[model samples]
Target: MKINIPETDQERIVIVGGGFGGLTLARKLAKSNYQIVLIDRNNFHQFQPLFYQVAMAGLEPSSILFPLRKTFHRYDNVYIRVAEVTGIKLAEKRLETSLGICNFDHLIIATGADTNFFGNQQIADKAIPMKSVSEALFLRNTILNDYEIALSTTDFDDRQGYIDIVIVGGGPTGVEVAGALAEMRKNVLPKDYPELDCSEIDIYLVQSSPQLLKGMSEAASEKALEFLTELGVKVILNNRVVSYDGEFVEMKDGSRIQSRKVIWAAGITGSLIPGLPEGSVTYGNRLKVNRYNEVEGVDNVYALGDIAYMEEEEYPQGHPQVAQVAIQQAKQLADNFKKRAAGKEMKEFSYRDLGSMATIGRRLAVVDLPNWKFQGTFAWFVWLFVHLFAILGSRNKLVVFINWVWNYLFYDQSLRLIIRTGAPWKKMDDVIDEGERG
Candidate 1:
């Protein structure tokens, strides 16, 4: 079954991917003359910034995700389709989706980014990436499964393999995951696994950069590193991960770390859909776009969010792959569409830097604004408020807030159920054997 959107004789604007950018554009274009058809792989729009919370069991996956149909219920011109966009036929102004072929007057590709394994198929197949809701649920399950395995095992080294969590990449996602895992070790694990020593649980954040939060200020980076260390996370800087064989992560320096849970938050590339000119893609696997966010050499096709790279004087290397940039670009593009329809002059898109912020744990965070930089409790509060307001649904906000408060006051995370749909014994055995050998 499909959610039918009324198609008027007006120009139909087809948006691929109901991520931050696409959703923002759709909301802005609500009640406009143009007909909007938004297609995504999933029906719900996810709040990606807080995915770590879902993985760490600090928040429910449903709390951070809202149904796309609910967001556009009031807009008669907007429609959402739960289908995977297979390829773009730019020459014919059509897109091939799982449902069928759909033609569009203007096509907007806002498919966002995916984890970049950098030509390593082994890592891609083995490591867990927290880029989507399903992936986060898998991580949550995997983490809980490790503890359950530890409870059953009598061997010390075998138990250590279950407890050791090596997070690849020291970026925001990595640091947040590390901090959350550290909190679990400090506050929750001891209570849950009293038979086993919680101290054996190791949380490591590995980064190739000289410091954590490379995109943020120095003070923020230092404060985050300090916070992570205080939480018992081993902060490894200027270190490169050469390989991982599902169980052991081997460093470039020839050192191997045994870990069953290796979360890959290292890098992300533009989630490119098929049918675009192969050479038109640029750095970070993004499609090269003109000033108006139009795909290079394609007139009717446009790209935004993490998939589009608009290299300007201010942003020579393209805008940072952040929600703010995506939302801002979408807003501008929506206005441009209106102006184009009215035969008015179009405006060149420019991004306003709203700065970056990351939360470490309860009461530990960092914020970098245009004129101000702060760390600690106030920054943490700022981080909380901003994210709460940014989330799509009021119910989602309430659920997340209550969960956060409960976690903060009690120092306990309750979502630790290991609900396995099917037995993955073969995969688990292979991972365990690999870890033992390493």
Candidate 2:
């Protein structure tokens, strides 16, 4: 059966994944003469930068996700569907989705990336990854459930194990999560669970590299380390996590950290679609695209966001899988489409380096802008403003800003209620496995 999109004489552009790239492109081409069909597993566009906050209970999930249909409300030519693209029929210009078949004159793959377990099935099966709203909610539930279990357990070691958290990777996500957990250990936990020894709640950040924030400025990295360290996070540098078994995290250096929760912020691999040319799949499972973001060896099939691997003279490898890169590429692609319709020359895409930022705790952050790098209070505010301003909807912005202020003033988060259907104190796979068996 075919998806029930209305038949239009104008060319149809099927965009798989309503992420940063796909959503941006659809909005950019709203006034164009083409019919746009946007598809995603979820109905909303998730603001990824705040996913760690959601996992750490610093922000609610709704504060970060905006409905795709709501976003394209006035755009009559745009259609939104909540469907997973299963396969691509390049010759037929059609997509096999969970709902039905979808035919398109042009296709844009912005499926983004998934957690990279690095070929370790054990780690992949056990470790929790904070990539989307549901995952973040799962992590939050797991953490809170662990503490509740800790309160009932008499054994000191087991209780410590229950509350302890080992976060792999010292990238922005890891650092932010560790910092938030440390803040909770200091402020919220003590007040909420007065009986438990909150001091025993350890937050470990393990990184394989010598420094955190590897791509950012050295000064920013140093400041981040300082901030996290001051927040009482045990930052382990130059060490790699080999495996996790939902009980203990084994490191490469023959050491093990006992923890009930393991957050996998180590890496991400592109979400590759089946039926694409095997040669087109490159390192990190990304699709090889040219300067114009067109997938090589495929006509009318393009890639954007984390899925596209484009190499330039300056960047021997692909450009960093950042939102700016995706947004810029989408803008360029949108312009190129218009240029094609206007019979004008299409321009090539070139990435302009806009620096990076990471916040460790309240009033502690590091920002590396193109011209300047800063840290501490100023950088923290800058980080807040940038992220707040970048959020999609005005209502979302206001809600998030109010939440931030409330958190800052109260030294507590309001959205800590563990709301789940059932399956208390269970890992992600265990829940899935139980469902499958039942």
Candidate 3:
């Protein structure tokens, strides 16, 4: 059985993963040229950079998400489906999805990336990963509930375990989460949970590398470490989280950090699908594509975003798996497709990076632009502006802007309610009902 898409004379372009890249490409494409089918497991486009904020109780998931169907409401030719694409039947240009087979003349793989546990099943089973809306919600619930559990637990060790947090990875996500949690512990938690001693809640950021934010500049890294320290986040460098059997986080050197809540933001590998030629898959499970983003061995198949590994003049291995690169590539690909339809030569994709920035806490951020590198209050506002501007809708931008302003004026985040109860692994309805009852 097929996916039940209506037959159209126009060449169909089936794009996988409704991420930044796929969303941009679908919006940019002309409705008349191709029948666009965008398929993703979720029916919403998540602003992934802000998932940390959701986990930290600073923002609601819906505020950073845009409905996939609403994204192309005006375009009649664009069809969006919420389906998990299993693999590809390349022989007939067919996609094997959970629903059924989906045929396409051109296929775009934009499935993005997944959290990298590095073959640690123990850690994977116990740790929380902030990759999606649901995952973020689970984390928010788990973190808030941990404190509640701490307040009543008779055993001191178990109480400490409920309050303490071990954040793996010192990258942007890890740093941001650590900073946010520190902020909460300092400003939000004490007032909310007066019964418990919030001051004893230790937050540790663990990184195998010697420095935090390894991809950033030395100055930024140094400032981040200092900032995190000042905010009461114990930074543990040159140590790897070897295991976490639900109670303590074990280091490579045999030392153990006692914490039940472990946040895994250390690394990411590509969310690659099967059926592509072996040569096309590269390091991090990224797909090997030409400058045009066409798969090396697959005819009329292209990949984009975090999943597309194009080794260009500027990017030898591949472009950094960031939203900016994805957006730029999607626009270029759309332009190439439109030009091809107009009987003009297709243009090769080139990424124009705007730079990178990370927010540590209130009035604390680092920005590295092409010719400028700054930190502190000024950089914080820059980081806020860039993210606010990048958000999809005007209402969302307004909501986020007001929230940030309020947060800056008064050191608080009001969205800290744990409206989802029960263990993170429990049923959704049960969690919601428990929260309501509590």
Query: In model 3, which regions exceed 4 Å deviation?
Result: 421-438
Locate the minimum summed-lDDT window of 10 residues in model 3. Answer: 429-438
Supply every candidate's count of residue pairs whose N, Cα or C atoms clash at under 3 angstroms: 0, 0, 0
The better-scoring model by lDDT among 2 and 3 is: 2
Worst 10 residues of 1 by lDDT: 429-438
The Cα local distance difference test for each model comes to 0.88, 0.90, 0.88
What lDDT tens digits, residue by residue, belong to model 2 across residues 358-437?
Answer: 99898999999999999999999999999999998998899999999999999998888777746657764586455311
lDDT by residue (391-421, candidate 3, tens digit) is 9988889888888888878888878887754
How much does candidate 3 score in TM-score?
A: 0.95
Q: In candidate 1, what are the lDDT values of residues 144-219, reduced to their tens digit?
A: 8788788988988778888899999998999999988988888898998898788888888999989999999999
- Each prediction's Cα RMSD? 3.0, 2.4, 2.7
Residue pairs in steric clash, candidate 1?
none
- Pick by TM-score: which candidate is best? 2
- Model 1 segments more than 4 A misplaced: 1-7, 421-438
